[model samples]
Target: MRFMKSFFLTTFNNHLIAYPTPINIHYAWSFGFLSLMCLTLQTVTGIFLAMHYTPHIALAFSSVEHTMRDVNFGWLTRYTHANGASMFFMVAYIHIFRGLYFGSYTKPKQWVWLVGIFIFTLMIMTAFMGYVLPWGQMSLWGATVMTNLVSALPMIGDYMVFWLWGGFSVDNATLNRFFSLHYTLPFVITATSLVHITLTHQEGSGNPLGIDSYSDKVNLYPYFVVKDTYGLFIFTFLFSVFLFFYPNLLGHSDNYVEANPMVTPNHIVPEWYFLPFYAILRSVPHKLWGVIAMLSSIIILSFIPWLHSTETRSSRFRPIYKIFYWTLVFCCLLLGWIGGMPVEEPYITMGQVLSVYYFSYFLTTLPMLGTVENNLMNYFNK
Candidate 1:
């Protein structure tokens, strides 16, 4: 027992206290720590909320209302869990963008990036399941629409959809399955997150300058710990503002109404975080192709470590790459905006065009840009 105690303490100190971090990394690096905090918040609040939640179709909505109105501080728990999801994704997206901009996916850190992407995919699955728990009008229909997309597969599509539904349609069985999975996946994510951090520490953290900082590193304690704490305080303040002042700002009004299978909403939209991929899914004319496009939009990110040919890691040294990076950012924002808009002419056309650019940015532009930058460097040296 004494040996075990010492072993654990030594491990903690090594990873958390004495870990070497790049000295030049700034507030953006803190987002990774912030993401971990969001996950913890979500897990704690989810556990509390689940205690009062009923997964049955007949009582699911009312159970949520009962928890809100009757249980002490239940509204706080529910809102925190709900909005905390958005916070998690917000922090995660920033962390990912920081990785992309600094080229954190390069060389030894490749597995760290890959594991982070896996965590993200799990987050999307968990969030999608959680969204259906309230059994609201939007929740029911959203589940129906999203599950139906599985039928786009060639052979076992219908069977897979049936398995996911656990019935002919979105009903009590579906809710039960989703609730079970939602309650379970966070623990899985937490475990996966440990792997991600372990891999990140194994390779050491990257910096804004995107250069080796092994000889000029600082301990994770004191300096970075203090900086991360400051970031946490600021993040808590903003989170509290949404929690107290505008708890439902990120939610859809249609969700306040109880689900009625007989009635369908005019616009069946998903949460804000999913809008970019949703736009890609809708942009394609065929259902199978649209689903493939939506899935590819995310999967393509995994290929970045291979697709990028430049030896340079940071956008700071690459002027042309920096411009293209921001353009890709704009393209994503436009896709997200287009996702929420009605499926009409100009929106459809716009989405199609941007979707093309989105793939092009990954497949053609990154590789070609690297070649151009390499050529420019060679000519200047001559």
Candidate 2:
């Protein structure tokens, strides 16, 4: 019993069960731990699916069908994995935005946020690779469009595309490599997430009140464990509902058709989670410039902690900033809506307009808010 108690003190109990937590955290904090749980679920399901999956272009689609129709409970595993990816992103996006709103991206927490971004980048890469494993219509066309975007670069553009596909275009090599990466990247995310959690625990969780606690910390055993478990149960229940009931809700009908290299779909769309950035990619007139615009949108996320220069942390304390923040959120939604529309007039125009506002919020509003907001509000006061 003594040895067991010593082992417990050194292992799970110390690091997980009894870890320190901020007393003032809310449901938003629950999403981070939930994202971790979702990742585990995704990785486990993916491993089992992989055991039966064939990554060849000829066999990939059929293998997926075989897994779904022939293998024992394979349908459940595949659906869980598919729906799990969406759930993972949903929780992660909420977790990220919560950090943004509550100012968890500020100074000492900067490393934590950066590691979180690393995890996100890996997730996107992993998901993109996973999407192609089915070798369906959208999977093929989507892979083609995205990979061909690399050819827009100046000199090495062709080389970049060639290097990625290992051929003139996406084929068996591409499918084989994508499957390998899809199987590999979750482990990367898992390792990076561990670093993120360690750094976060080291920094301690930020609170809504934007206050840090040196002495006010609470044990993770009961309070937060129960709260996070409660949140996970609700989240899992809702996710399972989609898994069993509306399995195809987040997937596209186009993907139901198998690959035909000679034929292209009337319209190609990436997944819903990627829509806002996809809209940005198509908003510009020039192909190369459009590619840059899309990359810029993502690259800009890393600089947010430095961009909004202020002593203030949380948007809760800054009334003016909250308005701008919500406007940015609205801009993202508009971009997403525009992404699914035909690139013809009003949609293109609308996408271009919203794209400007998206950048403006980060590049203009945030930097300028510190200088003008108080004066503008004070002028109104007088």
Candidate 3:
């Protein structure tokens, strides 16, 4: 028993306490830790919510209501779980953007980036399924619209849609399946997150300078742990403002109504986190092409490690890349805005233009800009 205890303590110290981290990494580096905290909060609250949630379509909405109104502090539990999803995505996006800015995906850290992308994809799937569990108007229709996109595939599309729905339409089977997967996929995310952290530690953390800091590294304990704790305090304060003050601010008003297939809402929109991709989907007229575009928008990110041509990693060192990177961020925010607007007149045209630029920024701009920067640097040195 003593041997086992000693072994466990030593392993923990090696991985968590004494781990070497780049000395110059900033507070932005804390988002990865924040994301883990969000996941843990979601998982614990989800388990409690599940104890009272019904997977059947007929009772799902009422069960959620019961949990909110009848159960002790159930409202708090539900709100935390719901808002926690938003907080999770917010932190994850910041973490991803920070990685991009510091070129964390370059060289030896590519696997870490790839695993992080996989975790992100899983989060999208899991969040969509969780949205459907409330059995609200937007929830049902959002699931219908997203799952139907699978049918846009050439041959197996319809079959895949059927398999996803478990019937001709989104019904009880679909709810049960989504609930089960929603309950299970978080554990999968947890496992994958371990792999992600392991890979990151193996490659070591990247700093703002985007260079090897092997000689100037510091232990994960004390200094960085205190920094992360400070970040956590700020995060918790903001999270509480939303959780306690305005929980439903992030949710759709239409979702307050129980799902009625016969009476469709005037507009069907997904959660805010999904808006940018949803805009990309709506930009194309053809169903198949639109679906392809939407999927490509995300999948293209995974290829950035190979696409970039310059040896320089940090945007701070690459002036041209820094301009384009911020422009890309603006493009995403614009796409997200266009996504929530009515698909008519100017919105459609704007979405089309933004969508085109979005893909081009990934495929053409990144590689070409990197090449130009490399050429400029060589010319100056020569």
Candidate 4:
């Protein structure tokens, strides 16, 4: 009873009590709160989808269409879940870029950001698997091509592919397992989110200036809660617009057809969020190198804290670094665009250039910029 009272009081004080937050936080910080609201939206809609969705390979596609054609409010549920995935990714990218811009990944709480990256990776895997459950033509071959990438691994690659497929190719077992895992992984993401939030709380939120443990620190309650609540309402409004008006905007027309393994899609592209890595995969003539590079791009992000050397907290103070950082952002956007195009000569060439910039920005430029800034600061001090 004592513990329960303490818990209740703590919750009330943290959420209800008006508190000041770092005034330096910009609207970019709103993205994380918006993401939380999206998670709530996705979860509610996803549960509704599960009730109507048939996970069986033979019935899954039919089940989706049935929900659309027959079930009351089923179309809204389905579209909300589908487009919610896109919206979740869209918000997540902005949240991540916000972290990058503010240098939020550096310092005493770098682990929090790293865990967020892992969540992002898991989210991608979950989305990829979920995309296959509709059992459309693209879904069928998309699963096939994607799962086959594991075969590029060393000795056990072929074995892993067969294990994932439960056979020589993607079939009933694959769909069933994907359905099971898709349902399971989001909860894992939620758990990781708890850890992410805890870590951030322990470190306390970073400011635009990148300073830590400043005396001017404010309580996180009323200030952020109000801002976050407002952000959530705005996100919900946008989500509702998609839910009602442009439900199919993020989905593929090819997905309306049932899974036909024999007939391949003319352009077998994954969703737009995945295009950059997919482009990386297709850019290479060899499957193995492409797979390696694709996975490396995400893993490399974990090493960023170590890659950068400067002691400063914010880019506002590091003018030269800010220029290169924005350039990297542009390069990433360019890479995403190229990922959707056919791997013709010019397209492939452009992808290669962007990919190089992507790696160079992290590995070479970040380190050099940090060192240069340190030297300048030392000279000024003298």
Top of the candidates by TM-score: 1
Candidate 3 has an lDDT of 0.94
Task: Evaluate model 1: give its TM-score.
Answer: 0.99
Backbone Cα, N, C clashes tallied per candidate: 0, 0, 0, 1
- What is the per-residue lDDT of model 3 for residues 70-162, given as tens digits with 9 covering 90 to 100? 999999999999999999999999999998888999988999999999999999999999999999999999999999999998999999999
Question: Which stretches in model 2 have alpha-carbon errors above 4 Å?
Answer: 1-8, 373-382
TM-score of each model, in listed order: 0.99, 0.95, 0.98, 0.95
Give lDDT per model, in order: 0.95, 0.90, 0.94, 0.84
Ten residues in sequence with the least summed lDDT for candidate 3: 260-269
> Which candidate has the highest lDDT of all?
1
Q: Residue 349: error of model 4 in Å?
A: 0.7
User: Which digits, one per residue and each the tens of the lDDT, describe model 1 over residues 147-256?
Assistant: 99999999999999999999999998999999999999999999999999999988888988888887889899989999999999999999999999999999899999
How would you encode candidate 4's per-residue C-alpha lDDT over 57-98 as one tens digit per residue? Answer: 789999999998899988878888899899999999999888
- Model 3: runs farther than 4 Å from truth? 1-4
